[model samples]
Target: MKEKLYAIYFEPEDWLAFRESRRFNPGDTARTVFPSPFPFYGAIRTMLLKKYDVKLEYHQKPNLSQELLRKIGDESQPGIIKLYGPFVYSESEGKRKHYFPAPKNVYKCENSGYKTMHLFDTKIKLNCFKIGLAWIPEVEGIKEVTESYIELEELRKLQSGQSFVLCHAPNLIEEVKTGIALEESVKRTKEGMLYFLRIYRFKNGGFFMLTDSEETVKEISKIEGVFLGSKQRWCRVKVEQFGGNIFQRIDSKNVAMMLLTPAVYDGGIVPKEGKFDDAIVKAIAATKKTVVSGWDYTSGKPKPIYHAVSPGTVYYLDKFPKDDETVVKQSYYNEFGFGRFVYIPYENLKQCEGGEQNDEQSFLALC
Candidate 1:
């Protein structure tokens, strides 16, 4: 049977606490919106085990839990599932509106450096300074800093219809929670008060599709364990047949892959410079990097620093590869869905197209 794609929405009840990298502790930080798909992957796997009794020994305990160990019985196989998003959302007029990462090629520079994203919708060049204006702190109230940095207006113009919210949204309320380890307890935080970042709850989540598990989807939806980013952060989810047209159609071979969640590579192979490697560039037109790191659950230790191709970073493919099997076998991270992306068909921007027009065209594909 040909499996169908399903949409699963995860609405966080409270501020989500996700630490992508464990490099520092005292002042832990969170990726404002960028997320890794592995955590969501693990969530789905756990759902299969709990809901439909899927036998996934290989995934549970790769070493001790193998196919040979399952000779005892033929438990139900996990439904083949593929996921695409953890896209942000915003509630307007009492309804949830979906948002993807801002379109690429319209970013402004900050004092630190250039920032990139994987969940963009189109491909077109733009002068960052001309789009928006920014303020320079050192210049003492100097606001004409577009030459070096992007202003809030232009950035929002690019992200307008998209569901992404800036880290510094005025409506974004945050709270600092303090905790302390009990005396004589064997907890990681056995020393002093631990502070946590808790932002006001908002509506933003992701989508998933199960290839072989039609019946399993029903059970999975009823299981009440669907989450967006981290296990600790529980969310309310809705599962149904996907109805939107944001995803690229099957026939479109030349595609634009926008990362909804942060993708993990073997050792962070995404390029940092404007140019990409020939082989990589052959398939991908442009690429950028987003650095992230987190704790490894198994080792209970901080994960290595990861120079991931950040979520919202866009990659243009001259020609989409057709051999799915070879693509998986040859690429280390492809199968894992680390750098997974969605296809957006190409369209040339009109000469008169500006921010508003570009934003309008972004949703045209959906229409």
Candidate 2:
């Protein structure tokens, strides 16, 4: 019935390691910025069960948890609606600033057409131009290229002083941790187990919303902390509520779907390009490849190496095809924040907000 919003904040003790691939050898364990949403879904379900005094199981049956989670549905009831974040939170001056996923369509301009190059200069430019309107990218710092557009309609949710914490979207930094490999039979330490390097750098937080149903807010409010993500990579999160909707109204005719979290599509690594339904609307401007992993319930093992469209990818639709049913029917990939996005008027980029310079005292505090 009513709308309820909850934000999850994770404060790591020191570092967290989300193993990207299944390889577990010393110096072979790698990590990524974020993990797939299936683990998060499992984590929340575990929390709910714990709150309800349900027994925790070592091994859960296939799809059994899905049926159990169905009981927590809202009035609209199309499964559970979830939106994960790739936003970056850092302090600017005395106030805090939020950085959302900049659409992949925005790029560095060369001459007339387009060029893909990182902007590494004295200062980054906040000014941007839309497709067909620009003349020079050689002069301007950053420019939006052909068919390059970002949706801001749903972003109106952030306009009303509602702050959100991002999940699984971390700037990866590498660090070395030391450990000893043990011998099973002799019960002694082995050699060549001195140290290993891992990508320990990541921001652990997620911002999501839930429909207030069956006293959902009541149970969640009582929660002080919950362990999210990998068990070995223990992350104690502080769950709290903030004001305003994280998503805004999508009233524009031409819209783009941007990935805030990595999405899994069928078949090949590249997301297939096609229309919504024959010619209702066509899909254009899919971005490059991103790797993501998840825990499999059926086999009870780490899922195979999978590729997903990275966050900040912009998928242009011919028009915002005015059929809610069509979007819902084709939105199977959106369950885990894959094809989830907001609709903005297909327009040029506006200057971003909150890019202030902070002193050392302020900068050190966030670290």
Candidate 3:
């Protein structure tokens, strides 16, 4: 039987901490508005085990019966389950709307309008090698929309090369609390050991994800709430069938792939050979790399460190891949939805119909 897609919403009951991989030290801030997929993976898996009446001892011992093991795989592997997102969502008037990271190729102008970057076929010499294609902004005085998000309707308009306005993301507030460390043996406060913990509380909305795992649907369907993030913060869980598609494939020779989640590639930010399936990468617009690592409860150790390409990164391709399956097959950690992307026509962006465009002379002067 084919698996069904479901939307899982997490409405937080209190402030939540989504810390990065960096060690939390005295005077350091442990806060983030967005979190990676690792935490959600662990949380859902644990909940599933609890629903099955699996004992904690079995997690460390791996002594489950063959049938039980098949249902929920032993440590180090998640059985037949796949996860995507931790995207932002809001509910109003009994309807829920989703938001997504804005594509890097899109820029916001000083005049409150948006513009798309155009790919130019020119060879430029770098420190060691030369690059053939580069993405150039259509107008001057525009900044890349990196730290912003767009509503689901805006994303659809973007995918279809239509003019769309940016929507303000839900507000997120950070609160810091102080604490002092104490010596465990002496039961006394450690001298000069003060720290501040920063946590986030959304002003209006919470995070959500899309999953097709039958086991997850079955277990979460029976529960009204679940604990997530640091301190086991409680969050109301809402699951519903999702019928719409987020990605719309465009048939074009020049296509752009926008990352919806951080991607980990063995060959660094760009894929090996600058190729994804049958399409060759012509240009790229990406943000700084981020380190992704987490604690492995099953093994009682830290997960392997990975340098991930940030979400919202856009890769211009020579053509659309022969098949979507082949493109996904080339990505790493795809089961966790790490390299998820949407393809759109690249040439349409060059028209600059949504926003003002500079003349050829001015653009050349800026270049």
Candidate 4:
């Protein structure tokens, strides 16, 4: 599934139809008009542009103070100011009001002299039947992030500096939280639809699919625990596109794959349906490869290749490296007798198309 998985976070109005219209691949997907202004906004938009060839940008509400809106602009693009609040959500004569919920844990604004959500419909994206954005972040991740957490003081503080707000947010969570989710504009290819479990994050990374149809969507939606994998929904590839050891020996790989597969299987946290925390664990007793993940930001955390890798335990790279360095330095070459070459899926294993968490673990496919 990692092969078909990608999550991008983009700003309101970042959608450049002029630039993206040319890139649309017929079979990919994109989800746009996310709930908030997340840093992931740019990354999600970029990936969608490359994959679905569509623009999924966000929009902001006009009710905010000019000063406040200006501050947010440092981190975002211009938002779409509106004519009225939710009252004007639709121009249709009979459509009385937009759905409303009694506000909770509401806080009055001290900085702007207003009340909680005083500026109703004060977000970037406007609701339109033509657009349908889905919510499944918590559904796919090891943990979930929500709006309730965001609507809190802690969340407000987290989003303080990068205060990019959206207009016309879809009512998914009751409140806000520390992390905001920016959904990319989705382009449905409408082919043989299927869901995938991209094992890139598993002990031995690989991609797998569970074929389903429109009927499956309704059933899956009711699961309440599972997440919608990708809007582009694709079929899986038989070959391995990502995963494996960074510096492994020829004989050690089979051992590695065996140890890792069960860890992901046993942990049972791989979104068999979304459940968090202890649901996932390392199978140190089962894995063989020294799962080494690479980091682009910090110096990097220590790779726990030895801890959970055993015959029974599954190996998690927590970030396994997938770069030319890993392949070039760890190649199965005869010239050097000491660091003897380890054969791995070099060309095919490194190019992963998923989001930030792609290298977090080494996924293995048991099926």
Which candidate number maximizes lDDT?
3
Best of the two (1, 4) by lDDT: 1
TM-score of each: 0.51, 0.56, 0.80, 0.15
Candidate 1 lDDT tens digits, 1-367: 1245665666666666544442335543333344544555556555545454554443233332454223211112223344555554454575544445453433333443323322223333232111111111121222221221122233333223322223322223334343333445454564322322323445343233322246446545665655444336676666766433333334553344445445554333333221122212222332355445443445444445555555555554445545423322332344444454444433333233445544334445444
Q: What is the C-alpha lDDT of each candidate?
A: 0.41, 0.43, 0.67, 0.20
1-367 in candidate 2: lDDT tens per residue?
1245555454444555443433345743233333455555555555666766666555553233555556433212324435355334332353323345555544544343333221111121222311222112234455444332222322443222222122222333445444445766886865433323233454433323333233444445455544554434444554455445444445655455555556554423223334443322223234555556644544545556556666665554445545533443454445444544544334322323477433322323534
What does candidate 4's lDDT look like per residue over 1-367, in tens digits?
1122111111111111100111125633321111111112222223323343333333532244465343222223422210000010111343211221111212223243212211111112222211111111111213211222122122222122223221232322112112122334655443222212111111111112121123222222222121112222221112111122222332222111111111122222121221112222111111132221111111112111111111112222212234312222222210111111112111012323756432212232211
lDDT order, best first, reads: 3, 2, 1, 4
Error of 2 at 309 (Å): 1.9
Runs off by more than 4 Å, candidate 2:
1-5, 22-33, 60-69, 72-83, 86-96, 109-219, 231-246, 249-254, 266-273, 277-283, 296-300, 324-333, 345-367
As for candidate 3, its clashing pairs are: none
TM-score of 1: 0.51
lDDT, candidate 1, at 280: 25
The 10-residue segment of model 1 with minimum total lDDT is 128-137
On TM-score, who's better, 1 or 3?
Answer: 3
In model 1, where do residues sit more than 4 Å from their true spots? Answer: 1-4, 24-32, 47-79, 91-95, 107-200, 203-219, 226-231, 249-257, 264-288, 291-299, 303-305, 320-331, 344-367
